[model samples]
Target chain A: MQQTNRLRPFFENITFDRDDNELVLNFGPQHPSAHGQLRLMLHLQQEQVVKAHPDIGYLHRGIEKMAENMIYNEFMPTTDRTDYIAASSNNYGFALAVERLIDVKVPRRAKVIRMMLLEINRLISHLFWLATTALDIGAMTVFLYAFREREYLLDLIEDYCGARLTHSAIRIGGVPLDIPDSFLIDLKRFLDNMPQNLKDYEDLIDQNRIWKMRMENVGIIPTQMALSWGCTGPMLRASGVQWDIRKEEPYELYDEVEFDVPYSDKCDNYARYKIYMAEMRESTKILYQTIDMYKECVEKNETALMAHAPQYISAPKLDLMTQNYSLMQHFVLVTQGMRPPVGEVYAATESPKGELGYYINSQGDAYPYRLKMRAPSFWHTGVLTDLLPGSYIPDVVSIIGTTNIVFGEVDR
Target chain B: MRRYSPKDNVQKKPYYTDRYYVAPQVPKLDVESDEEFASDLAAIESKFTVSESYIQLDQLVVYIDIADNLGVLELLRDERAYTQLSELSAIDWLAKDGKFEIFYQLLSMSRRKRIRIKAYIDEAQPVKSVQSLWRSADWSEREMYDMFGIKLINHPFPKRILMPDDWEGFPLRKSYPLQGDEAASWYEVDKIFGKEHRETIGAELRDCAKVDRYDTERFSRLGFEVPKGADISGGEKRKKVQYQEDGGVFLIDRFDEEKTVIIRDKDR
Candidate 1:
């Protein structure tokens, strides 16, 4: 059997009666508006796109291959590089997978803290997406406003963890450090100001004629099409499918916190953008609940961070230095790593983008036998070729931005 | 809290029953029931070789034969309403019978349940492509091919996704080395700097000059003889040679320099 290129029609099948002025456009493995290292080959007839093929993998770093070589705990840091904008969500997803594999139950206080960090990370990611997407659509002022708030969130993250970008704050069983004393104050301040910041963004682009013309009715994907294409997060929500891993599966204390899942039946770029903005507000609500829970736990004199599993989770640095048994456990954990039972488990969490899942197969080894990351961006990127066809050539950038794809996860 | 023994049945029943009664509960929906799943699995038992199926980590996991991949996936998608193919990944089981395990994670939006389907295939065998069933399988299957070398039959464009088009050997294979093989040079680096510059850099960084005379095997392997003038105790002025290669200047230190170290400016 012979296989022809799917993007191009066969020469024998081409009829000369119609105009055959199809121009093949390679839209950026390096183009500025491509968002990241995405190379889309579009077959255009005049201004409309006849066919679109996304050639990804330029940003691939073999993170999965690297996971097989490193110990389970060592691989947590590498997950940060996958979706760097939402690094904590990646870390939390990997940590949850490892904890589930080893059956290490996290403490109540630790669970609350983990939930708080993940929601904060979600806010950071959504802000970053809003900033870049706004900039892509010619709303430069929104970029400035969103980043102004983003810096405050980054400062809060930096106060908790040492790093700003790839904050490997999450440990296997729980979080490494407790929230700082001033962290809540700073978070409250940011949350109080976030609504105003969101309003500032809305003022710039929400009613602008150009923004509406560029977004509405363009790149519209139906609910069925979106689900079949495996689109998650705001992309799926924009298509009127209220499928969120947090609401459906309820991982990491999400059940305790109350927040609404925003959805829109418009199923266009504007609907997706609106869904993202609404989601930020919902995340803020969840954040407020998480903070209150944390304060309550502190008042009750409960352990606020780190699970008490001695074998599965490493002891704290102070405990490792003082206690002899803790020292031995820490030494062994650091050197050889935890050995999970011979089984496989898939754990997914609702990251800012969508369902970020980790599938780990451990053959009773210190390192994962096979670790697979179900990056939501990967599936989102796959739908581009489907969505881009029949749309205008200029609308490609709008579609890409609205889809909110980060190549880190797409090409991981 | 007092621990109640099973022998004290009266107290145990009251305590346990009260605890359950007091807890808040949401009314259960008839959708995604275990009975429905059991009946569905029973319906497809003849077509698919249902080796094992159980709940793990609160998600349904089913292991099916490799040949029935298409039939089972289609049944799940068309009949059972598992519309969303959440993830499709491959696992290398080289140690156990040298087979590759492929996982299909399906999520039913209406049912609000996730089911993971697993199938094992030999290293060289090609699994049936589910691109027609779920569009998400296109890239996932391509990635599986790129990483684990498990081919997807009838895939539209089956090529190396993460690795380069001509890259040799799958990187995620259990047999593949972590640092990669020496035979396959970093072609991207060579593309940036010309082949001649790459060879020059490689040769300058080789450990031939760093070996001691006592390590005769390493010295001979590099085709270098022990020079009588290898002594470098003198405080001689170090010669700094700079070669402009590919828009960046590489500085070479020549005083007791075992291997060449290149330092470039931050802006370069």
Candidate 2:
């Protein structure tokens, strides 16, 4: 083995079998297209890849280990860094996992708000993926267009949660706080104008021949293959699987919200793209419904969302010097984290990528015993080793981006 | 705002009594223990949630003894439904007294269900190699090795994935002291600016050490015994100063904070 290892490169010039050849090439660990710090060892015969092996863990931050040590409520903030893109979704999943462990029902208003932010996050996540994927395939204008709408959504999110990107707006039993009126108005305005922006995206790349050639039939994971690989979200939907966690499990106010689960028979990159666009449109519909629901809830009562909610414990009496009991309650809730039961629960949500599941094990402590993130990116990325083989080198980037695997989620 | 409901959207009816390929329901098997695990595994398979497992989309995960990890992985990838080797990772239970666990997240796109294969390895012998089934396991396994000190018995090219090759020790392990040079900076700047930045490191040290007039009443409200003439800010700085002297300096203090110097006239 040592002799062969030393002579391996020398033997490359003298091929024993010319007709059937294999060349091992390192694709990343630094390549811009592997999505993040992922490395792919591709065994190829000319332009057709014979075998593609993925070498991940470049982004692993040991979040699970960290979660095990932190209190359940203290762990909520950590969820924000998991996906980082659709952070609220991760936070929601984590919070829901904890909530399920404690068997606490989220209030009606909080449920609606959770659904609203999650759907909006889903739209933004898909937009980033779509924009970047298109750019990877050579459509540059789509980035600006996609980001324009994405920025609008981010702004709306920032206004609501006072943070963008990793908005840890979700808490154990409910949302961190209720959405203000102006935030809702801005969201409505954005959703109102999103259809045209989506059309603009379609106009720029949907039917373009080059775009079709690059995405259509590339990285095709058939229905059987997709299911076998545990593919979820758009990737599974692209393969014609009609399963979606939001519809199946009906978490938060998903059952109350009206939207469509878009699937495609095409089972290719084009199908994945189409599925996402359809999903964005469906999200817009959900947003409109959420806005209307928010309005109705506001008009029907002057009470805050948490006004009638059961307190984990009674807040301390109004300050001796000042009668600001509400402030005291808010402070108490913020400082000491929520308590969950000593049990385990798995909560899955239909993130734009796939079935984003959060498995939380609570030992009745403030923190969790285990926090497992079922990242869609990890599932999507896992298929690349199977999909990349028999495809050209350039198609590698196409497959990677189309898979929409976020390294943050993958490595986490 | 308009609510959209697709009239043509065909929703699949969810089955109520289906238990074909659902999650293994083994009476909530003691997740902490590995005794009689195979029997539990059998029970889990039989009590799966769905009746027709083939039609359902589920992720199939099988937890095995660390000794039998490689064998089970090979069987699942070669014999069972697993075709796509998606992700392989490990989790550290430094705080827990039980065995350290490694999770292999597998996807059989053909079956449409995902499963997590778990194996427990003792700290004494933290090595298991499953790189043969999926070559992708090589680096992830190495990463698990690098961070948690979990060895990969026969991994072809096991090495660090995130940290540099020369990194001193695994950063992910809970037992590993959070007292690394990186942690020093993180502890400092994370408080101010509401976000952590390089500058926050210095700000934290200064804030911690900054001398503040001791108010016994305010100190009482904080539920702490008042230290005589000791400012809270001074206390913060003293900690930083001691920390800096202990060869774990953040190195940002030399430039960021002002150094006190006693000026004496040359004539005197």
Candidate 3:
């Protein structure tokens, strides 16, 4: 088939007729508002939308195929790229799935540590959403403020796991290592300081009339529709659904933790914004609780956080500590790889966007037989064409940005 | 191509209902060949059962079958309670009889349960497309089609999802060449002779000259007492020492040299 040279005749002569008044507009593959190379072919009637055909796959990198070619342990690094903003959450989800398939019990302390990283990752992911969402709407200051918090979170993560953007901290059985002493202290300080910062963020955008006008009733998705559409995380909760995997299914000691599932009936851009803000606050509270648990575990000398071996060796205490036994254990763990069972398990977590899930099938090998990732942004992005029909073209940007669709996650 | 008319630019397609976009309204399809479906599929009917099928891994190793896939997916989304079409992907069973295995993950937000849906498709058969049910399935299905050569019927525009438009055959298929577009560039005749396997004169000299070379200078440097005839007997240890010295000298040169070209043109 020959390509259509002029999609809509940008420079053609302008004329109007009443009989057949329909317009076709291509929104993006490069448009910043489309949230990562998403192109929407919009059929329009005057200013209103008649239909939106989304053209995607520009960002697709065949992550599922790559997962097949790599060893299970080798693929842990790839999880970091899935949801780059909340890398730990993706890591946790993937690791948990593998762990479930293998049937290796996660120690309580490791679970708590994983939960802490997850909560922190949620905060980081939300902060990114806030920053980019605000940027898309021309709220430049809020972008800086949101990133200010994100930078701090990344610093804390770097202190703990060494890498900021793609930390493969969580392993199959547990995390690669226990939280550093400095990491625990910094986490405590961050949790203490984040609430007031969150308040500042709300003050900046929550009450601003311009912000309200831009977001309020635009792109409304009803609770019934949201549920029917398979929306999860804030998108579903913003529609007044009280479902959260952390509370309902309670994996990774989430049952032991106390937290509230923030929800709203508004089911619009404003509702999603408010829900995410509330979630950021909730994540902060979870952080403090996690820190307290970590401290307790440290006080009790919990060996679960400590790497175990065939022979007992005192924990390295620091990564650089060079003990003969520690070196031997590290070498063995790195080369041999942990073995899990021959079953399959799906692990879900309440990610910033929604319930990010990982499904693992183990054939009793170092690598999994199959691994699948459930990205919330992809689901949320699917609803955009539905939400953009009655709304203005500019509102499309707000809807897409508010959903926080990362290309890394989408393509993966 | 149609001529540019201003009227043609005015009308846009109606955004589908959120319910339709999020979850597909699966039609009730009565499937035959019941033996291929999983026994637990009956249990999935009571809830929002998205997919209930068996995929045979090898022979008797039952996984998920594609025969009743459409029905099972409809149940998971429309009935049993799994409303979220979270993930859709395919696995290439390289040595297995089936060409590819597609995996679907469904999440029931209300019920807080997740289940996996696997479907096995033969090399040429078109797999059922779920894009109509879950709009999110659009790109996922396209990706599967692009990478695994699995056809998803009813996809709005089932084009290549990941690879470039003009790219050849499905890249992820077991039959796809592993070397990719670089198969012809894997090696060069000049590379094989010029540097890669060029044996050094010193190595040949060492092998041919059987005269024992012993030195106390090396043993003292490593804080070991020089033993008589130990240098020739400890060739392994000497080689290790040479490698370490080479590494140290290379490191020092790397730091000291400002515009040093590590490789010589003669070698290339």
Candidate 4:
């Protein structure tokens, strides 16, 4: 009888025909540092990578196709699934697109609240990036510390909305709900404690010999390469482009607030680290301004968070309860949905990862005729093919860590 | 609860109708309204024949010939400073126009403007690849080809990006059903179990929470576990599930049924 091999299935992918030094290693799909469902096909000659091909789509949910079949309001919840760590950012990006299509000016108070939510989301997303990237680079303590602060920030977010992670907090034309009675106070406490916590994170890993050794001179993306690859947000900023959408094209309450768009010419992991740290500090500054604005607006007793465009926006709770006309309209809006203008609008917002844009094409229908999500991760993932070659195998993890891609956005 | 019905072609069926619903159109202005757009359009018209140019929602949208895509983008990149190829994809209009309107959204940081270059191509025409110009288009083009079944002429790696290589249908097409066609529904079964096993295995059980007490393969009786395909026309006695056995383990504390709390609230 022939001997049965126990490891046959494991060896099935290994090719018998190959050069002695050259090898092709499938890096992920199950790898912990893959972030989410990223399978990197790396061709290695000895220890250095010869060529890299990223085989994505492991997390593809066909959400764009699903969005085409859904109404605008129904699709808002699904937007939270993309770039899920910063769910409200996706929510705002979609909301901004629909609001632009409907041509409704959002209330000033709602704008303040939306800005607060977005900045808080940015903090959450960046902290998560910091934690995971640090862990990926072999700094485990920073992960625990960063997550501890993240939990507090999540509590603040939960106080505003009912959910923590996938917060479909923003609605078309305005925010869905106003800040709770305790929201500002909680936000203040969290913001007050944030600087010290952020400094703690920096003190832990930013100066560590091993962290610097692993980070510096690795994954250097030149300015031209960054722009050509459509890199935005911190990725572009770190590569010496001072383009911040909030600065260039101010959406929401960004123009009212003052903050610096930090950039560095180093264009490597270390430079990106410095930029991320600087951004978090800048977000804290933005939050302070939003809180001041929110307090000032609250004095006028402006409780109308949702815009007054009834045909485009849903009826307020008070209207739904008191008026029969509002009830009928609400029923229709929920059943069929609001039909935006028969045109196309592409709205881009600077999400923590990059410029998250939603392009909506409406053909005089309740559902979008074509909804294309320009996810930053999709392009960032594409850049890996160019970024990975000639670098050592270990640098792949550092490069991916700095890239900060969430597969939900990449595979959508 | 609603009665169970087949959802085979639900999208095709008329479910809700709003006869009074009026679709509003956003105003599109002339390109000469803005001096920058006028100059840009003039520059574009000097080299290639621009079919149409207009400013919609404050962004310049220009329609050009399909063949001039690469050249126009190159001109914009080198001369016009439109550095980033923000997005590239096709809108499926085969049902209405029998053509795909492929659009390239170009972003110029220097000019602080976004210009959309769109071109119409026939259903079977292979799109000219712009991967040579902007590296971002590599994946976006592959994804466009994958979703809409658009053919590409000069893409470096001309394979499916989002979908599997052997997938049967272009899912983003208007005619393809959202839940999928018959071939799509059986894709996993056809790949893993072969077509011969279709009758034995049946279609995919989509309801995640659906539990059939008789299905021995998936649903196991908590304490009174049984063999596969065992005759269960007659029910077995329900055994009490415990944290510890009746005899109790050697080193563990004695089982306390009264102290154990069971959660009944679904929301909690």
Residue-by-residue lDDT tens digits, candidate 2, A149-184: 999889889888899988988876677577876887
Q: Model 1: which docking level applies?
A: acceptable
Q: For residue A283, what is the lDDT in candidate 4?
A: 98
Query: Across residues B143-208, which tens digit of lDDT does each residue of candidate 2 receive?
Result: 567767777677776777556565666665655533334543444355444454554224333223
- In model 3, the runs with Cα more than 4 Å from the true position are A1-13, A19-23, A306-340, B1-65, B76-79, B177-268
lDDT per residue, candidate 4, A1-412, as tens digits? Answer: 2333785434444544445667889999889998999999999987899999999998888899888888899999999998999999999999999888889989999999999999999999999999999999899999999999889889988988989999999998898888999888888888899889988998998789999987999999999889889899898999999999999989997998999999999999999999999999999999999999998898988778889887878789999999998989898888888888898989999999999999999887788989999999888888899889989988999999999999999998
DockQ of each: 0.24, 0.07, 0.14, 0.46
The candidate, 2 or 4, that scores higher on DockQ is 4
The TM-score that candidate 3 achieves is 0.73
Best by DockQ: 4
- Candidate 1: stretches off by over 4 Å: A1-18, B1-36, B189-268
**TM-score ranking from best candidate downward:** 4, 1, 3, 2
For model 3 chain B, the run of ten residues with the poorest summed lDDT: B7-16
Candidate that beats the other on TM-score, 1 or 4, i.e. the better one: 4
Fraction of true A-B contacts recovered by candidate 2: 0.09
Instruction: Write candidate 3's Cα lDDT for A64-98 as tens digits.
Output: 65665566677889888888888888887887666
- Model with the higher lDDT, candidate 2 or 4: 4
DockQ of 2: 0.07
